[model samples]
Structures are given as C-alpha cells and as structure tokens.
Target: MLVLLPPSETKHPGGDRDPLDLAALTAPELTGVRTELVETLVKLAGDVPASRAALGVSEKQDDEIARNAALWTASTLPAIERYTGVLYDALDVRSLTRARRARADARLAVGSALFGLVAATDRIPAYRLSAGSALPGLPTLRAVWRPALSPVLAALPGLVVDLRSGSYAALAPVPGAVTVQVLSERPDGTRAVVSHFNKAHKGRLARLLATTTAEPDDVVGLRRLLRRAGLHVEHDGDTALTLVVPAV
Candidate 1:
C-alpha cells in the first residue's frame, strides 16, 4: 500500500546533494505542471518585494524569497529530509533502521504544492509554496493541479492510505482510498476532531505503517495492521478509520 502525506511548510536551509531536476522526480507525469511552477517562482523571485508579497512573507522572512531565487541552483536533499516540523519530527526518518527506512522509501509519498506528489526519497531543495498561494497569472493551485494530478494518483497500483490535509488533498482527489482521521475523546464522553496535535498523530501513524511488514489492501485489513501496531482505531464508514486519543 502507498501512504500519502502532507508537505510541511518549514524546511531545512541547505543540503550537500545536487541541484533540482524536474525530470528526475518520482512522478514524471507531473513534470509539466512542476516546470510551470518552478519557472513562475524563479521569475517571481527576481523582485524581492514581489516574491515576499506573493509568498505571504514579511520583511524579516525575506530570506525565503532568496531561497526561491536559488531553486534550480540550491543544493538538494531527500524530500523527507528537507521538511522540518512537528509532523516530520514525529516521523523521524533519521532514526529508523536501514531496512525500515528502505520500506518507508517504497511506501511513502508526500502531497506537494510545488511538486504535486513526491516519493519519500525524491531529492528536492528548499523552497516556499503553499496550497493557498496564488501565483501571478495562475488560477487557484487546485484548479491547475487537479486535472493532471488526479490521473497519476488514480493509476498507482494497490491500495492507498491518504493522509493529506485540507488544501493539499484538494489538489487531487484520491477516490476509493482509505482515509484516517484522528479524534480526541473528552471527559464528558464527547469526541471531536483533533487539531494542534493532529499532524503529529498522523506522522506517527505514517511512521508506524511505513515500518511495518504487513500489507493491507482494504479498510478492514488496514485497521488490522494499525491495531497490530497498537493504535486505538474505530471504523467511521466503509472507507474511513478514526484513531482515538485522549483529550490533551
């Protein structure tokens, strides 16, 4: 099964690897849209003020514009390695065993605003782009992405566990894919969707699934695998799982 994750907004600044190359990314079918976005960002980076405005950055965060300017020339790192946040910190790919790391590389994919979807080991550089960013002359990112992105995701073999959040998931719809939602149980026996800690929980779930040996092809089998990993899971529908956590 393939597990789809959301990309983090924060990233490491530099890397030792080579520069960006669209043709070499995992989903070649997205190269067209990727190239368009890359060029748009690079050009927008020419004017620092324009870049800052376009990316929703303030004066202090202008360095992000410089990063965009160097998109093609900046050193690269694996997509998983480049991202840094609560989610990535929880996933913690750095500490995994070699075999489990390899398994993660094979099973994980990140839903990207810039790259559309990239595999775990896909090399990428530091850049700033979010699902909500409206680039000059471009329509909503979801509008530009959906048509090209959906077909590629649909064509992937085997079951898919979609873990992408809001706008990232809006970029492409993964029909029939099993989705997992994290819910918090309150003292009054009430349950509500998790918020702040949600990403961390999803990250943990992704890490657990990535390192596991079991391959689940359906929602029931997926729940079985998650249960085997010690998660407290409950079914939501024919295609959804709700993992319960005590309220914080």
Candidate 2:
C-alpha cells in the first residue's frame, strides 16, 4: 500500500552532505515542474522583501529567504529527516528499527508544495514554500500541480492512503484514495473532529502502516491492519476512515 503524507513547515537546517537531484527523486515525470519551481524560488529569494511577501512570512523570517536563496547550493537531508513538526515528531523515523526504516522508505510519499511528491528517502534542502504560497510567475500551486500530480497519484498500483491536510490535498486529488480522519471520543461517548491530536494520530498511524508486515492492498485490509495495531479505527464507507482517540 502507498501512504501519502504531508510535508511540514518546520525543518532541520544545514545538512553537510549531498544536493537535490531531481532525477534521483521517485516520479521522474515531475522533474520539469520541480526544476521550474526550484528555479522560481531561488530567483525569488534574490529579493528578500518580495520573497517574504509572496511567501506570507513576516520581516523576522528573512532567514527563510536565505534558505531558499541557496536552494541550488544548500546541503540536503532525506525528506523524512528534514521535516520536523508535530506529525514528524510523532512519526520519528529515526527511532524505527532498520527493517521498519527500510519499509518506510519504500511505502511512504510526502506531499510537497515545492517538489510535488517525494519519497521518504528523497534528498532535499531546507526551503520555504507552502501550498498557499504564490510565486512571481506561476499560477496557483493547485493549478501548477494538479495537471501532472493527480494522474501520477491515481495510477499507483495498490491501495492509496492519503493523510494530507487540505491545502496540500488540494494540490492533487487522488480519485480512489482512502483518506483517514482523526477524531476525539469524549467520555460521554460523543465524537468530534480532532485538531490538536490530528497530526499525532496520523503520524502514529503512518508508522504503524509503514512497519506492518501485512501488505494491505485494499481498504478492508488497511482497516484490519490498523485495528490490529490497537488504534480505535472505524471504516467510513469505502473512501474514508475515522480514528477515534481519547480527548485530552
């Protein structure tokens, strides 16, 4: 099964090894768009004020622009290692066993604003680009991405579990993908959409899915595996899942 994850804004900086090689990233078809976006970002970084305005960052974040400015020359880390946020913190790939880590690289794909989609092991540099950011010459990111990314995503060989948030999901829609939603189950047996714990639950779920020996080729098997991992999961029709966790 293929599990798609969303990239986080917070990242670890200054990798001392390697540079981004678009050909080395999975999905060879994305090279054109990747080159276009990377060049646009690097150019934009030359004008700090314009970059800040376009990226929706405050004056204090000029360092972010510097990161983008060195897009071509900056040191790189694997996609999983670079991202550091609530979700990634919970996924914590570094703590996984060697076998699980190998599985993670094979099964996980990160939905990215800059690179479209990258495998967990893809090498990338620190840069500032969110789904909402509009660069100087490009159309809406959704417009720039959907034409290429959607078809690539839809053609994947097995069950696809999409765990991306709205903006990133908007970049490319996977028609047959089964999506997971995190919910809070209250003491009174009430259920509500979870905000704070959403990323954490999804992170844990990603880890579980990545490590499982069972190959869940469809939603039923997916749900079964999740349940076996001890998550409170509910099958929501054929297209979605609800993972209920205790409210904090």
Candidate 3:
C-alpha cells in the first residue's frame, strides 16, 4: 500500500554534500514541472520582498527565501527526514529499525508543492513554497499541478491512503484512494472533527501502516489493520475512514 503524506512547513535543515537531483526523485514524469517551479522559486528568491509576499513569510523567516535561492546547490536530506512538525515528530522515523525504515521508504510518499510527489527516501533540499503560493508570471499552483500530478497518482498501484491536508490534496486528486478523517469523541457520544492534534494522530497512523506486516489492498483491509492496532476506526464510506479519538 502507498500512504500519501503532506509536506511540513518546518523542516530539519542541512544534509550531505549531494545536491538535489530531480531525475533521482520518484515520478520522473513530474520532472519538467518540478524543474519549472524550482527555477521560478530561485528567481523569485532574488527579490526578498516579492518572495516573502508570494510565499507568505515574514522578514523573520528570510532564511527560508535564502534556502530557495540556494536550492540548486544546497545539500540534500531524505524527504522523510527533511520534513518535521507535529506530524513528522509523531512519525518518529529516526527511531524506526532499519527494516521498518526500508518498509517506510517503500510505502510512504510526500505531497509537495515544489516536487509534486517525492518518495520517503527521495533526497531534497530545504526550500520554502506552499501549495497556495502564486509565483510571478505563472498560473496558480493548483492549475499548474493538478493537470500534471493527478494522472501520476491515479496510475499508482495498490491501496492509497491519502492523509494530505486540503491544499496539498487539491494539487492532485487520487480517485478511489482511501481518505482519512480524524474525529474527537466526546463523553456525550457525539463526535467533532479534530483540529489541533489531527496531524499527530495521522502521523501515528502513518507510522503504524508503514511498519505493519499486513498489506491492505482496500478500505476494508485498511480499517481492519487500524482496528487491530487499537485505533477506533470506522467506515465513513467506501473510500473514506474516520478515526475516533477521545476529545482533548
């Protein structure tokens, strides 16, 4: 099974001397668009004010723009290690055994505005761009990405568990891919959507799926696996699963 994860805004910086090699990333079909976006970002970085406005960053975060300026020559880190936040922190990839890490490398892929989609082991630099960012002289990111990314995701094999947030998911829609929703179960038996800890829960779920021996080919099997792992999972529909957690 392939689990699609959202890229994090907060990333661990610095890597080995090797720079980003677009051809080495997964989904070679996206190389053209990736290269286009990267070049545009590098050019935009030359104008800090424009870069800050376009990327929705403040002067305090100017380092991010500098990272984009050096994108082509910057060192690289594996995608999984590069992304860090509540979600990735919960995934705790650094603690996984070598065998489980191998499994994660095979089953996990990240949804990126910059790269389209990159495998867990894909080496990438720390660059700043959001799914909503609109670079000068280019179409909306959604417009640029959907046409190119959707087809590639649609053609992937096995069950796809899409855990991307709304914006990234909009970049590419995977028809028939099982989607997940995190809900908080109140003492009154009513449930509401989780907000603050949603990513944390998804991260744990991703870790579970990555390490499990079961290969769930469909929603039914996927739910079974989560249930077996002690999560309160319920069927939302044929193609969606709801994970119920205690209200915080």
Candidate 4:
C-alpha cells in the first residue's frame, strides 16, 4: 500500500506540478529522500522501464520492460484505485484497519488521496441518529456502510475531516428542512440516516428500500431520494451504492 510518486505532474493534476509545500526538511534530509526515490526508481527500472526512462535512462527494450513493470506495479498493489500522471502516481488504500496510518499516508502523499471515508462519515450520522434512539442493533447492520463506502464517502466535502472536535459542522447552513446524517449498518453495510421534516420522501425511501430487490434499482431510488433532499449523487459502479453528500 506504499504509493510513491515523483514530485511532478503525477501528484498535482490540474494544480501546480512542483514539490508540495510541506514543512521544509534540511538539505541533507532532502537529499536522502531524493536518493531513496532514485533508488526506488532504479529498482523499478529492472522490471519497469518507464520508471527508469523517467530518470533519463532511454532504451527501446528498456521502455518496453518499463511499461510491463509499471503495469505490474499498478496492478499488484492492494489499491482499489490508482492513477499515474506525468510525474507521480496516486493510490487509494482500501479494506484496511485504523492501525495502517503509514500505509494510508504513503498513498495520500501522491495526490488528493483519502482514507477511512466510510468510518469517518458514518461516525457523525450514527451519533446524530443515536440521540433519538439507542443504536443497539446499529453495529449489527454491516455490509451496508463500512466496507463498501470508502470510495463513495471520500468524494464528500466534509466527511473526511473530524468535525466533532471542531466547529466546522456548525458553519454548515441549515437550509430548514434538509439534514443528512451518516449511519452505520451491522453487517458492514453503509447507510445514511437522513432526517428531513418532509415525511413523504422519507416514507418513499423506506418503501423503496424495503421492496426493491435489485441492487441497481435500490441505488437508483436512493439517489433520487438524496437529490430530493438537496444532495448530489454520483454513480460509479452498478453494484456499488450511491454516496449522498450535501450539494455545493
């Protein structure tokens, strides 16, 4: 899960391509990092010629070898998602535990990467929902929230940040009737406990979830409900459920 990238366009997308403005390390430390990076690239060159070519080593056979190596590296990593740019590559670490912070950070340093989207997003919603009823079976509703929501929740605006320890959530405008909270399921399912005073949509959503047997239709209905609740929905996978977030 260690995703490394050159400090180039690979890491910055539409943003700037230079090195990130992280806390400046001493020159010797920076040089050591560069040396390690070069060594990594050299190792990659033995199998990944493109990695070597990036370091100014050019040979047709080397290029072919590099291409295959790059493909292998990209595919072998446990990352659920990865992207290679002109100068750096990015990865998303998935299906991991909280103890894997270093691995997650390595993936994140490449670009606009995220980690623990599901757990972080679900925490607030679950807390909010528990205020009305004790969440006894909450931990039991698995398969719905935790394992599947990592990628979906990452795209959300405020879910990745710890708002409970700060006043960030307070700054959110309460547009009267629409309030969405994240909810966890027992069997590792991901869900949202949306509390809108508009009872009709809520009732509709409940009915849809209860009756819809097909996963696609269930996600479609969920997306429609979220839109009605003033949230934006993005559909990526047919089997993957839609992620709901406050609209910008």
Candidate 5:
C-alpha cells in the first residue's frame, strides 16, 4: 500500500526547515522508474493486438500472440504462477472446446486491464472492439482478457494516484502480470513542465532551479511539493503555472 501526506498537512507545516526532504533521491533513480513503467506497458500491449487482422490470421499465427502473452505472464508476476499452470492444464482439458474457452477468458481479462491503463495515460482508448466485460467460452475469453488486464491493473487508478500525489512508488503486479506503458507527449519543445510532488519527500529537479521568473516564495512552494514525490517543476515563463513532473 502507498502512504501519502495529505495536501493540507504538507502545505502548511509549522517548520521553517526545507518542507520536503528529497535530497536522498538521485535523478537517475527517478528517471529509471519512469522509463521502466512506460516500457513495461508498451511490451504488454504489443503482446495482444486484438485487431481484426489478428483474429483473421491462421490458427498458428493467431496463437502466436497468445503464446507471447502466456510467456510474458509467466515471466512477470508471481501471483500468476498458479494461473499459468492452470492455463497449461486447461490446454489439455478432456474437452478441446473447454480448453479453448478457458484460455480465451484469461486473455480477455488481461486485455481489458491493459486497455484501461493505456486509456488512462494517453486519454485515448486502445481497443475499439472490446470493453471490460464478461465473455463466453474459455478460449475466446482468454483471447480478450489476458493481454490487457495485467497492464491496466498495474497502472490505471494506482499508478495515476501515485502520479498525482507526487509519490514515485512502484506497483507490484501478480505473477504473469504486465507492466504499464506511460503515454508520451510529442517531441515538440513545450515549455511547461508537468510534475508531481508533495510534502513528505522532495524532488531533485525542483531544487536545481534558480530563482528568477517567479517569486522566491512560489518557487519554495513548488520545491516542497516535488520533494515528496521526487518530481520536478519547469516552465517557459509564459504559462500561468509551472509544470510539475515525476519524469520527463
């Protein structure tokens, strides 16, 4: 579970000392966490396309994505260790149809979760055809769920909560779980810096800025918030508010 300082408590503590203590964290560590979160989600999405083309592929080709999802699930979260084994056993279930049904259900859950995460981050939904819902047969269900669910569960509400609160906590997923891919902004040079921060911890980037455009006290407020989440603040001087970001 992640613990956060309430906004009220952080903003108005009676101490005159540095409000948030983030000197303990280094820049590289913060950047690495952000990169890992994004990369993991991307790979998970790639594992499941759920596109019409994927569905149209020959059985051999169609199963390839499923196989990758299975492999990824096997490698990532420990909670899925038993579930993956169940999947293996289901493949040989006396009834071929039942075996297929089981696989599909699992896949569907994974897919929905991943899609949700993608949507939360990018503000765009990933899957057009599927929503998070119950499915029919086993194989068909796994086909829909497994790919997206893990990533979405890893990110979505949890990751976003952390981002908004300015905490850089990692979300651990069940075994066979997928990592979340963070949505990236375009390469165009935007001046505002989006950041996350609070009172308990401090961000390094916040400390690095020199006092200039904004008032000294405003910079201090920004610094206190970032230090809690190991985030930073940046602005092009024109934007009304400075950008607080946990990662670039």
Candidate 6:
C-alpha cells in the first residue's frame, strides 16, 4: 500500500548534501511542471515584496523568502527529514530502525505544491510555497496540477491511503484512494471532527502504515490493519476511514 502524506509549512533548515535534482525524484512525468515551478519561484524570490505577497508570508518570515531564493543552489535533505511540524514530530522517523526506514522510503510519499509528489527519500531543498498560493504569471495551482498529477496517482499500484489536508488534496484527485478523517469523542458520547491534534493523529497513523509488514490491498484489510494496531477505526465508506480519539 502507498501512504500519501501532506507537506508541512514548518521545515528543518539546511542540509549536508547536493542541491535538488528534479530528474532524480520519483514520478518523472511531473518533471516539466516541477521545472516550471522551481524556475518561477527562483525568479519571484528576486522581488522580496512580490514574493512575500505571493507566498503569504510576513516581514518577520523574510528568511523563508531567502530559502526560496536559494532553491536551486541550496543543500538538500530527504523529503521526510525536511518537513517538521506536529505531524512529523509525531512520526519521529529518526527513531525508526534502518530496516523500517527503508520501508518508509518505499511506502511513503508526500504531496507537494512545487513538485506534485515526492518519495520519502527524494532529496529536496527548503522552499516556501503553499497549495493556495497563486504565482504572478501562472494559472491556479489546481489548474496547473490536476491534469498531470491525478493520472499518475490513479495508476499507482495497490491501495492508496491519502492523509493530505484539504488544499493539497484539492491539487489532485485520486480516484479510489482511501481517505482518513480524525474525530474526537467526548464523555457524553458525542463526537466532533478534530482540528488542533488532527495532524498528530494522522502522523501516528502514517508511521504505523509505513512500518507494518502486512500489505493491505483494500479498505477492509486497511481497517483490519489499523484496528490491530489499536486505532479506533471505523469505515465511513468503501474509500474513507474515520479515526476516533478522546476529545481534548
């Protein structure tokens, strides 16, 4: 099974290796669009004000723009190591054994506005861009991504568990891909969709999915796997799973 994850806004800075090489990333079909976005971002970085406006960043976050400016020449890190936030912190990839890490590299992929989709081991630079950001001379990200990305995702082998947030998922629709929803259950038995701790739960779920030895080719097997792992999983539909947690 393939586990699709969302890219985090917060990332670890700097790396010890060579710069990004789009040709080396998975899904070579996305290269054309990836090159276009990388070039656009590098050019936009030259204009600080425009870059800030386009990227939705404030003056205090000028360092983020600087990162974008260095996109071509900056050092790179594995896609999984680069993204850091509540979700990634919960993933705790560094704690995994080398064997498990290899499994993660094989099963995990991240949804990116800049690159479309990158494998966990793909080397990428620190750059600031969001799915909602509209570049000065380009069409909407959805318009630019859907036509190319959806087909690639739809043709992937086996089951697909998509854990991307709304905006990223909007970039490309994966037909027949299973989606996860996080909800909080209160003492009175009422439940509400989780907001603050959503990513943390999904992070744990992704970690479990990445490391498990069992291959779940359908939603039933997927639910069974999650349940055996102690998650409160419920079938919302043939292609949707709900994870219930104690209300905060």
lDDT values of the candidates? 0.92, 0.90, 0.95, 0.27, 0.26, 0.94
lDDT of 6 at 243: 94
Clashing pairs in 3: none
Per-residue lDDT of model 4, residues 19-107, tens digit only: 22212211122233323322343355464434433333346435433432332122122122222322112112333345443334322
Evaluate model 1: give its TM-score: 0.97
Q: Tens digit of lDDT per residue, candidate 6, span 84-196?
A: 99999988899999999989889999999999999999999999999999999999999999999999988888889999999999999888999999999999999999999
Better of 3 and 4 by TM-score: 3
lDDT by residue (tens digit), candidate 5, 1-248? 11111111101112222221112212222333323322343344364544224333344454333433333222221111112222223222223354443332222221122221211011111111222222222233234343433343444322111221211112223332212112223347433323232221211221122111222233344444434445433432421233333334
Query: Model 2: runs farther than 4 Å from truth?
Result: none
Report RMSD (Å) for each prediction in the order shown: 1.0, 1.0, 0.6, 20.3, 21.6, 0.8
Candidate that scores best on lDDT = 3
Question: Residue 75 of candidate 5: its Cα lDDT?
Answer: 22
Model 1, range 173-214, lDDT digits (tens) per residue? 998999989999999989999999999999899899889999
Give me the candidate number with maximum TM-score. 3
Q: Distance (Å) between predicted and true CA of 108, model 3?
A: 0.6
Clashing pairs in 1: none
Candidate 3 lDDT, tens digit per residue, 101-144?
Answer: 99998999999999999999999999999999989999999999
Which parts of model 3 are misplaced by more than 4 Å?
none
Models sorted by TM-score, best on top: 3, 6, 1, 2, 5, 4
Candidate order by lDDT, highest to lowest? 3, 6, 1, 2, 4, 5
> Candidate 3 — worst ten consecutive residues by lDDT sum?
229-238
**Residue runs of model 6 more than 4 Å from their true location after superposition:** none
Which 10-residue window in model 5 sums to the lowest lDDT?
A: 4-13
| Collision count for each candidate, in order | 0, 0, 0, 25, 55, 0
